[model samples]
Target: MAAERVEKRGEEEAQTRLPDLSFVHDKLQKFQSKMVSDFEQRLSCMVEDVLQDLRQRELRAHEFPNFEKSDRKSTWHNRVTNQAPADVSDAPNGHANGTQPRPPLQSETSVRKQRRQLPEKVFVARESYLTALLQVEHMRTIYHIFYIILVMFLLNVICYDYFVDGRFDLGLGTFRGGLRRLHWVLGVWLLEHVFVLALYFAFRGWALVRHRLKPHSSLQRFWSHSCLILYISSQLVFCFVSTSLCLKFNLPFVSACVLLLESTRLLMKMHAFVRYNAERVLNGKAKKEDAQEEKEASGRPFVPPLSCYTYFLFAPTLIYRDSYPRTSHIRWKFALNRLLEVVAIAFLYAFIHERHIHEHFGQYGLEPMGPSQLILKLFGMMLPCAVIFLCGFYLILHSWLNFTSELLRFGDRMFYKDWWTSHTYDGYYRNWNVVVHDWLYEYVYKDMYTHVFRGSKVGASLAVFMISAVVHEQVLGFALQMFFPVMFFLFGVVGVALVFLMRSAPKVMGNIFLWFSLILGNATLISLYAMEHYALKNCSLSNRSWTDRLLPAVWRCYN
Candidate 1:
């Protein structure tokens, strides 16, 4: 019996070591059956391992920042989403998705205190409308007409120079002079980029340090608030220091404009980064303490990669995200055409300035003018200003933005909507410059409504207008080295009033009214700014004082 049991165990071991091919008649068939069995077992194990890895990755992807509630798919393209419908548009109030509803008021007098989540900005592959439209024959004619106008302006310049000066001249001296100190502008921009890069690393380090601290402890809260104070102080210092340097070095108008504009851009980028991540950093403990919250926060990044932060600093949109929709390949031809358009439009501006603006207002403050002359000047400036308005729209919003987007291979092409079709100021404001509008709406308007004003819609709207007005005024005022608040009054007061008044206007009337207002407003703006610019140069200061800089000197010039 012992011998039989030992023999049985030895036979079991031998059978486990190798599969039997007893039915095969040839050596090749025996080898093939053995190989097939071994391959089947290995394949099954590999598939199981792959499926387990995929499950882990899926869990990581579901984790969202504290600010976002649901991860909806982009309206423009198909990437993975939370099974949201593709047909719906992004509505501000969150009604389109039917997921979030407006909260009820707390009491008869009190408003809702709960914060509303903003709709995520979607990115998809698309071409700018004008870029596509110009490809058609009818739309191409308008482009040709503009080209012809450019040629006519060039001819007029050459003819006038030949006749008056007895030599051909392009008269680009002013244009060239205005663009001086370009190298200084470039240097400043380089430094600004470097500073922002350092700022990102600083933020990343703080996040890591904070992550290790006891969640919701006094030390954690202290560091969080201290970081906030430091960030605000540093940004203010940077702004003031850069502007002061511009004044101290006496940078030209164009250089000052570039530097200041860039300073504002970086400031916005930094704020967006900080504000978007505020919840995650502050609520780190919630993930660990609560089981439900832990499921959502598990595998989510504590701090986003440096690469993502760096990309946000330069991306066309002010709003930041981990990733954006991207194109499969770059359209080199389209990029080249956009580049050419930018150059052509720049020359068009110079020509318009020389023939229309400079001829009428170049010597503005040097001579006395009657009220009739002033009215005539404003009207005459209207057509040229309209041209300028169109040129600027195409140059920056379409050409320049498209160029950068193409280079980045960014898929979102809806930078600006069909703002021209809008009948009301509200629609116009939202459609025109969709890039900047998104940032303001998300960070400024939404935050105020959710946290500060307690869902007071009117108060939130007013706050948005105030913030925009101030920023606009700051850019224009600082660049021009004056304290005139014409932009502030126009944007905050007059523009807001128009938005309300035009609400009831008829479609046909509204369209006409919108155009009329735009032309008139732009004309007044250009005329006043130009007059003041030349006035400061030509008019003598009685006593050099702050009042002289703050007050309009056009009156002095006329006196």
Candidate 2:
């Protein structure tokens, strides 16, 4: 009996160790059965990406057919969306058996590209045009544009301040003498308009590309937000630190520029509150609806938004007063907070004024500087003196830059209460506050995009962008403003927000239009603001009275 038990155990062990012929046969058969689809599906993604890189590089039509892609698909090709090639078009869905003839995949070295993923790999593009752009095989070439622009600005500033001084010489001569003055105006304009929003916009793009690459896992998003935070924070630290250092002591322009470029690591600390809020809003809505359905079976209340169109009646309530945290909800809090912020600001300013007012009487403020002088003063405040660089940094570290918060607050409310505020909705947070608006788009909008628009990534991507631009404009004003910033910011933000629009309804489609209005209105408003600031700043010289300054600022609307 012992020998028989040993023999049975040995036979069972042998059976377990042996490969299963039947299982292998089943797998091989299944693979062969789906071989066409597997081959075509992969080929579809590859071919689409290759052709897309071609079309983007503006390669002339090759052997590929001029098939009619959806309008949204064409737009996706134009816009900077991070969607898979197959997902962008219907080519894969229509793919049939061996009889079906599809576009041949190009093998150009420049045409190849690997999607932007964290675990990186070098791409071998098939085409030469893109090959030059991506010689090292990286993500999109837009970064090159930013790099070139930065270099040009610095060079122009350097040449103007040191060399040109006013010589009608050749090459960079014209730009040399005028550089300082131009820098005064341009710097003021940039500090006012571009600097604060630059990183936020860039992060919007980074987030989109990340969403495209990673279709699964929520935790990986931490890496995405981290990348954004790094990029943005780099800009702020580099600019502030460099300027703070340079103005105090004369550092070589080369050293300053190099330091600014390198040390300015990317850091985008965009808010996650928006995403969490949207998630809760959406999840809560669905769960409530589900519970309501169950309760209805037990005879409970049923509430609909009256009619599809009538939903607008509840729009304000839905966005502002819902249990959810919304822009409107935040704005009211911000407004009240800003009021206290103003009082604190005024107290601080007044304390400084009282001290300085005794030394220079009423001239303690920027009274010595005329309008242009005031700009120079503001410009000086924005940048740091090489000598006082550390002092100022330390001071700001301790005291919040003395008066900057108040100044920004004063300016913000002034602008908000001006003629433009009527053109927009009541609350600043709803969308006017670009900072928080970007936060909403990234966290809230992006979540919806990845989950809802699983199949048609590109269309959903562009729609959200377009919608954001259009709505922001209509609400902000189309007749007065240009739409690029609104477009740029909204495209970035809405592209962010609409990432969720896939599972969203046409009502939810309102995000698109809101973004549109934001794009048009804000772009125009800011453009008008900066141009007016530059054009009429001199007007203050002619008139110091309230009406003089106010009139000139208003007249800037025309030119």
Candidate 3:
């Protein structure tokens, strides 16, 4: 009876421990398999890389025969001497000690040396013929046409305002109102600089602290993480405060837009700075293991130069680099031309807003509308809307950015590519805003592809589009003080679909499609938004319902 009880107890204990042991065994097996797979993949990549190096060497040899021969001879002699056995000697008959000579073996160092000797390929910005034409003296006669048309429009607007309103004002009342709000705008601008300067100093101080600490220690890592969180939190607080002030003060639309845009840019700069430095620190740590030199592993934390950071704040780029290609001198005449163009375009925008946009859509719900009337209204607004769109693009992306770049002598003038002539929607998106696109590509797309989606290009692409669309919609919605999702839908859905479709189409057809889509999309946005904006102002609702307030007024203007 005692033996039976002892046996039963033993059996129960064995059964209880079996599952735990098996679970651990299963985990180990999985880990082993993963390690093997990763090792195989790495080995395969290394082999491929070596093969590619050989092929490139062959191509270079064909292109430069004399240089290639000299390189080959030197490499062969080094290999033969270094690797040859002490007993073996070179014979006159190309033999070693009466035996056939061994073949020359390429060393990893020699391959690296060859790679280092290869010339680096330089990238040049490709501008369209039209952009180049704008620089020519004779072609610049085209500017006078726009100037003449602008003057005529101004005259007509002045006459209409004076005759209709019995006032000789050129909308100076709005200008004066904006000026009154200018002090608030300047205050917010100053606050942003203060926040940025504080963040920079914080980073510098943390770097100094890190340099004094032991590498990879728990205390050091904890402090580093704490500082990172603090910097990010501070930036978030700054953005929140800045945005609240802009909304609270009811700043001018353009002024609010500029403030928000600059705030976003500063945040981007901080992110870039942190990301770049973090990578450099990680790389430094990684190289330390294989460095074999005391100088290479001196244990100093990576800290970016203050001047580089300052320059990046003013530079027309999102990417952070220690330095950039620069021109020797500023082009004063070109800078002046661009600045003047920006001012002229600003006035042109104001005139359009005062005359055409307001006149057509100011009384949307006051009048009964038929389909024909709506169609005519949209058609009439299309040309003016297109002109506004083009002028805004030229003013900001080309004129303003280029002017700043020239003043700083920044050499990368390709702020935008030839987006006007882009054959595909994907191409257009890439070329339209190279600065923003680079940020998205590096941080969003690449990060998603690497970490989240794990190499799913489609998933990564979708993430990028979603992020871009949301940011764009946020900008427009906040600036306009409206909750319209028209731009969001167009950007995220229609634009993405067009990217895929236009990707495979022929150049001519794709370009035509691109332009047609642009025209239609811009027209639709202007028409719908304008109608809704005016309807909200002019229409009086019978019942103050949630639907009436939340939904677009264009849908129920008659109600």
Candidate 4:
């Protein structure tokens, strides 16, 4: 009985031992597979290194022609053969020892090279000069000074108005007047959005249609070009019609100008989108000829997703991309601060208009004017004009745009560069509005260089300046409801001349000159325009002939 129990216990032990044995076997199989994978990876790395060395050797051979070809071949052969260890060489079906040839390394190397050459489409940290500047104590102090000055100006205006008129008006009446014209503004704004959406969809749909058609067919090409031309024509017609209606109805010209500017901005963005995608599509088609190419190599279809396009429409950027670097969370405090700044700036602007601008130019054009009075007026307006210019810059380019960018989590905050420190007019122009500058650089200047001028940088630059000047003049003309070429001549001619003149000046002197020129320019623009505006308002234009009306009231209103 005892012997039987012992044998039964041994059999039970054996049965338990079977699971342990199986587990050990499974672990060994996994370990063996891992080892094989690790070995293969190491071997692949060695092969790449060997290939790179061979390439280096080939390059050296070219540099030193005295190196014999036979010596080079021998060196290459020895290096390749010795790259593998004896253990690897002895393995069954191993590639070493000349039994099996190594796989072609060209494709893998090419892929790696292509990846290395790919452009980064996002901003790096600390890329925005303004954002960085705002962090510095000195710059922050300067900003605070400006804010205090603006507030003080606002208070002075309010007190002066109260003392003179015996009323507690804060210029809300002007605001109310603008509010009454809000419908016109809203209508135009909505129309612009609708037009942009329509254009986006039309472009996307056309691209899809082209895809379905035979590749490179004349019908497809003709239709695509025709649609593009028609779209451009429609945009031009919209601008003219909007301007004409504003003039005819005597609508709020400022609101009309805003609408026109917004429309132009959207049109430019749409053009960029179409142009960028067209190139992408062409490259994709070229890559698609090779069946073995990766899908990414063939590139994305020309039609961007609607969600992306919509986001881009509101994004504080002119360059369109499917995706951008996004912040993890919205900084509500920062956004609110910027918005509050905008409000303060708006109030300051209103105060300036009521006090300085309306007080001086409220009556008429350079009437009863002597040389002394004209000079005094120009000098007096300089500081106010500079403040206005600064406020305008901060409100639009920095605060408002930054607020939008933060809300949207747009990572790139470089809407403008260090334009304040610009030593040349060209530099200032390039840095003043980076968003617009980038668009001009990429689309207008580059296109001119590539297509129209055939690499004439001067021609491309001149073309860009002309286009910018014309657009600026159009905005100014529409806003003021006057046919003024002051902005055009200043920006296109004087600005261009200064760019070359200041190009070689000492940095400190150039910056001083830049500020001086800017202050003088702003003062001149504001004074002259204000005079003309009030002249037209106060003077009897009904008695004037067509030629007289066409001429600036500033020039002949005194007569």
Candidate 5:
């Protein structure tokens, strides 16, 4: 009885020492709840203060437009302009570079319209998709696989030459042959650049002449008309001269390709420069009363620096702006890598043509084949042609453009998008070459819709398609020295039809169809063009006339 009583007393003492456990737990919970409530109250106050500050800033943005110089350049999505602000020190009558005065912001609708008409381009600091993707291990592996395939192709060429002739050879004869007359290509390109540069000074001189003359004076009017005539005549003459030189010089196919492509780029750049500045020149004439005010507002004359014009000529863009987002410094290593890829891809093209394209089609005109054999040839060419197409994309759009952009310290590097994943033709066309598509959209499609087609979207879209088709055909025709409308038919007719048909297709089905069409179309292009090229060489025409030159040589080969 004594021992049990002692144990009971010990337990009672321990419980007293522990204090009230439940009371302590309740107190802690109350403390946590109070802390949370206090935090919530403080956070709410902070958020409210931030909101008030934002509201004030927005109000100021509206009340004092001068505060928007920097913001205005960046506020719009994918749209930016290099025009001076309204309060700039040297704008002719408070206008930017003598640009037409902004209309009164009388209504919301008009404001929206004005916004739509703003320049539709923005340059932001960005790396290309492939450059970013290649940083990841898995994506880098895919790129490595392409290099491996190219190496395998080279080995195959070596083995073939060794087995046939009992001597090792690189089998690059066809490639070397095609790249002949490179010096001529370079010469023509240099000459074209000289002409393009001349245009800038010519326009600047005319602007100065106009700037000095009295506004609305008869002499100014005559000079303005003369300037218009000069622009038109110069452009036409440049086009004629460049094209005739390409044709008359009897340049090699590759030389012609370079000249033709460069010519198109120069023409587009020239037009963009003129079209943009012409508005500014005309605005000065229209707003003569505001000229003094603009001069007072701006610190200097409104002419763009020659450096800006020269930069645009080599920059990986077609749009003309006085300023663009730029990097702090050029990445020489990055530029070197891109240039190396260009060289490698050029070799890849030559190998593909020699092995798969030229070998099969070289004897096309000399030999006869049945329909089944022809179909087999067509199918066989599909994979090779698809590879060539992808290489070509990388060569011109990615590698070449990126090299130039890096060298120039251009910030916007989005020369293409994820076109391979596109499920619709419309998406593919838009994403394929963003640089060109942007030019077409801003200058061609929008202008047609607003001014020419009068709000007819269909007409504008059609115009865009037609222009693209014709230009594509022209390039190929000049390169091959033959007239073939296969590209035109595929691009303008079947491509458009597929776009509408696949507009709402299921994602899986649409993507499959898109790839199928691309492969098949590339196959068709390579086969037909190759056959025609060989046909012209191997087959003799009884009468070599201008019309005969336009006729399909492949048909004559069979006849």
Candidate 6:
């Protein structure tokens, strides 16, 4: 009886624990299998990433732009500028100085003889008077320039209508009434050079004084004065000449303004892109000692600045005018390269997290990440959105990183703004979304300074804002899949007005207003997010119901 009871107890215990053992066994098998799949997926993704890098490399190397064959008369290495005097022996370069004497005009027969006598002239590293200003170096300066332009443009336009004209149409017969008076008021002595001059002396003088308490070089003085001039001039052109032309031509004021703004913005970006090679690449590729110094100082392995360098890889092929080789453009090649990178990174992440997710699930194709794992994915989506939004906000916040990280650090933090609006404000936007900032500076502000307003800060500011608003709206629309960046700008312009007006007020009053603005700003942001999220969710669902349903099918196919 005792033995039977013991046996029965043992049997019961075994039965109770049997499922646990079986469960463990099944769990181990699932984990092993899933791990394998995840591992494979990771391998696949990595392979894809490498393939992408390789493809871009090959494309940029081969596709090079389709410039006319005649243009090939000047290879990058050869091609001498006509800087040299006419009767000189070939100084080392075999071309006399910077200028090469013009060969006599000839039909094809004489051309060959001249070619034999005078080889191509190359511009070597003549003394490194200045290193190429890489996009990274130029980004912040560019961004601030853009923001200044945007703000000035917005302010003038706002003041013209909301405050000056007050009303638009003249219904009754008063020749001097509504629209005409409004247009006059908007166009009138809205700008005078006196206050602008005061601003220039105060800011520029102070900057120079602080830098060295006395001007060291004519170049420094010239740079400061010109910078100030640019601000004033850009404002005048954007506010007066450009605006008047729009009215005279019956151009859509806002649309015309936006066009001016966007072109400059793009140009600014291209400038930064060009400068990157000037600053970082040329120096980086020079020698071993430089590479060691760059790594030690920057603490970034791989390239001198990995993120910024990536921009060149893509930008040289797609964005810049004369970069890369002609044979590189394969159809749909860029798209394929992007897809491959996505696969590699996705697979790598999934494989790493396999144990954390379902033990049995391996490479659940397109499986939505659970709460914990999802933050990274959400981060990627939100980052770009925030960047586009902040370009408008940069007009409002007036910082670099919230604006210009694309240039300084390159693509690494190209989509970040966390550093921009922290308490000090300096640390924030300065390096955050550098790419767009570069665009604004070179195309809008610098052009205005050197060519447009002749370095009038206020004018540059106005130009940048108009350009920034238009570009932001377009980029945001593409990113968020909606329209109304225009509305966003209206709100942003209002925000700018509030900020500047507050800055001008008495300290106590300004502080109060600033705090009030800050709180309102937070609430507005929350509201915008909720609105955008609701809109996106509804739209995505409406458009892709079948895909939502077929998720399981996708999983099966991938698995």
Query: What TM-score, computed on C-alpha atoms, does each candidate reach?
Result: 0.77, 0.22, 0.72, 0.74, 0.77, 0.26
Candidate 3 residue-pair clash tally: 0
**Candidates by TM-score, descending order:** 5, 1, 4, 3, 6, 2
Q: lDDT values of the candidates?
A: 0.75, 0.35, 0.72, 0.73, 0.78, 0.40
lDDT of each residue in 404-507, candidate 2, tens digit only: 32322211111111111222232223323332233334433454455676535465445555555644443232222222244445445644554344333222
Over 4 Å off in model 4, which ranges? 1-122, 125-127, 285-300, 365-367, 542-546
Q: Which 10 residues in a row give candidate 6 its minimum summed lDDT? A: 124-133
Rate residue 534 of model 6 by lDDT: 37
lDDT (Cα, tens digit) per residue for candidate 5, span 1-559 = 9999999999998898667876788899999999999899888867876886698579646643333444432322244442332221222121222123555545887666655563556555556667765765667888998899789888877787788767764645655576677787788789888888889898888887887888799999999899899889988887777667767877767777888888999999988887777777667533223878666734223556688888888889997777666677777998999999998887777777778987789888788867887898999898889989898898898899999988877777778877897889989998899889989987899889889988787899899999999989888887887788999999999988887888877556788999998999999988998988888888877656788776788887776
Off by over 4 Å in 3: 1-131, 136-144, 162-168, 171-174, 177-180, 285-298, 540-549
Measured by TM-score, the strongest candidate is 5
TM-score of 2: 0.22
User: Least lDDT summed over 10 consecutive residues: which range in candidate 5?
Assistant: 86-95
lDDT of 6 by residue, 291-397 (tens): 76766645221222333334443331112222222221222443343344333333322222222122222323334435454344333334223333444343322
Model 5, position 424, has a per-residue lDDT of 95
Candidate 3 or 4, higher lDDT?
Answer: 4
lDDT of 4 by residue, 178-229 (tens): 4456577677778778878888788767766777677789998888889878
- Model 1 spans > 4 angstroms off: 1-117, 167-171, 285-301
- Where is model 1 poorest over a 10-residue stretch in terms of lDDT? 76-85
Number of backbone-clashing residue pairs for each candidate, in the order shown = 0, 58, 0, 0, 14, 78
In candidate 5, residue 385 scores what lDDT?
93
lDDT of model number 2: 0.35
